[model samples]
Target: MLYDLFWQPFADFAFMRHALVGCLALALGCAPIGLFLVLRRMSLMGDAMSHAILPGAAIAFIAFGLSLTAMSLGGLLAGLVVVLAAGAVTRSTQLKEDASFAAFYLVSLASGVLLVSKWGNNVDLMHILFGSVLAVDDMALCFLAGVASITVLTLAVLYRALVVESFDPEFLRATGGGGAWAHFGFLILVVLNLVAGFQALGTLMAVGLMMLPAASARLWARELPAMLAIALGIALLSAYIGLLLSYHADLPSGPAIILTAGLAYFASLGLGRHGGLLGRWLRGRHLEA
Candidate 1:
């Protein structure tokens, strides 16, 4: 039963093996970033940024067809542009950072759709909108793994600064610790991961993988380290379940993976030990009794 359910699928298909590895890499890189995003109450930023990269990718697609280098470069450039422009708007106007991000992403999303629908075919648009892990080639897998490795290393270096800034930016700034650079670096990492992930999960569902597992972990852990670990576990498990569902049920791979994460999030909401609704209610009843 185990082999048929788990091992057989992978053993039977090379695409399955490749997809599993890609998902593993994505989870490893995105989970910690997702956790930090949640802690900072900037969860939607992931979604926004995902969309914000679409225009560049779409333009690159129009200009260069399916060239991976062009797509990556275009997406990175577009994401950085949005990030910087949003920062400028925040600094120069009364609008908050989130508001600025929201405005920019809306424009970016619309522009991307317009470009793709106008210049590209349905297949091109679909690929850009919803990625196919089954299509992950050797080069794509290497890209995913490299992004994960860099993300892990960068996060390790920035962990202390990130934690401090997430909780209290003023505190990080007051100590002459170059919190600005850390924040910029973190944003760069976020864009890099999203750009890499968009190839496998697509723009629409990429943030779901990043956010859902992290949100689920948030309900189960009080400490950052614990939350990070829980999110990683959930992400890995969701990726496996999602890949199996995609393979067996003929569902779209990206949505299947994200739906698995959604399941974990709901389960945590109801049954998780820390700060879960059930746990909170049970404790309240016990205290009253």
Candidate 2:
């Protein structure tokens, strides 16, 4: 029974194996970026950027007819445009950063839907909005793995700058200009990972995998290294269990994985040691005793 439920799907089907690997890659690549996003209080930013890349992919689809390279480049360009425009506005105007991000997110999402509707078929639109991980081939797996490697390497270089910027940007700025470059480089990493993930998980659901695990880990951990470890572990577990759930229940792979991550988030919320409700209750009982 255990073998049938837990292990047979991947053994029987290559698609399941591919999807399992792809989801793991996505989780690995997205966790650190997501954690930093939460640390910087930019949880919504991931969602915004995910949608922000859609129009670029849509344009590429219209022009290049479903060419992956074109769509990837277009999406990267589009994401960078929004990031630059939003950052520019935040620096130049009275608008707060979240508001700037929100404004661009709405415009980009609406425009993407409109463009895809006008030029592409419903199938194309669905593919962009909700990617099919089950369809991931070896080439796609390579892309996801490559993105993960690049993200890990980039974060290692940017680690000190980003952490310092997160806790004390002024201090980092006082020392040198590394903070500025680090900030920009971090944003680029965010967009890069989002673009890579969007191809497998869809724009809407990609950030779910990214942000949910990080947020959940935040409730459980206080230190950055611990948080990153917990988040990556949660993402990987969710990917594996979610794929199994999808296989047995005939559910969508992306949403299933995200839902599993959501389950983890809620579980963390209730039972986390940092400030979870259950932990607080337990502490109260101990005090009374």
- The candidate maximizing TM-score is 1
Which regions of candidate 1 fall more than 4 Å away from where they truly are?
Answer: none
lDDT of 2 by residue, 1-289 (tens): 9899989999999999999998899888899999999999989989999999998999998999877679889999999999999999999999998999899999999999999999888998889998888988887788889899999999999999999999998999999949989988888988988888887888888899899999999999899999999999999999999999988899998899999999999999999989899999999999999
Worst 10 residues of 1 by lDDT: 1-10
Model 2 scores a C-alpha lDDT of: 0.91
Where model 2 places Cα greater than 4 Å from the true spot, the runs are 285-289
Q: Candidate 1 residues 35-110, lDDT tens each?
A: 9999989998899999999999998998999877898889999999999999999999999999999999999999
Question: Candidate 1: RMSD over Cα atoms?
Answer: 0.9
Clashing pairs in 2: none
Reference-based lDDT, residue 154, model 2: 94
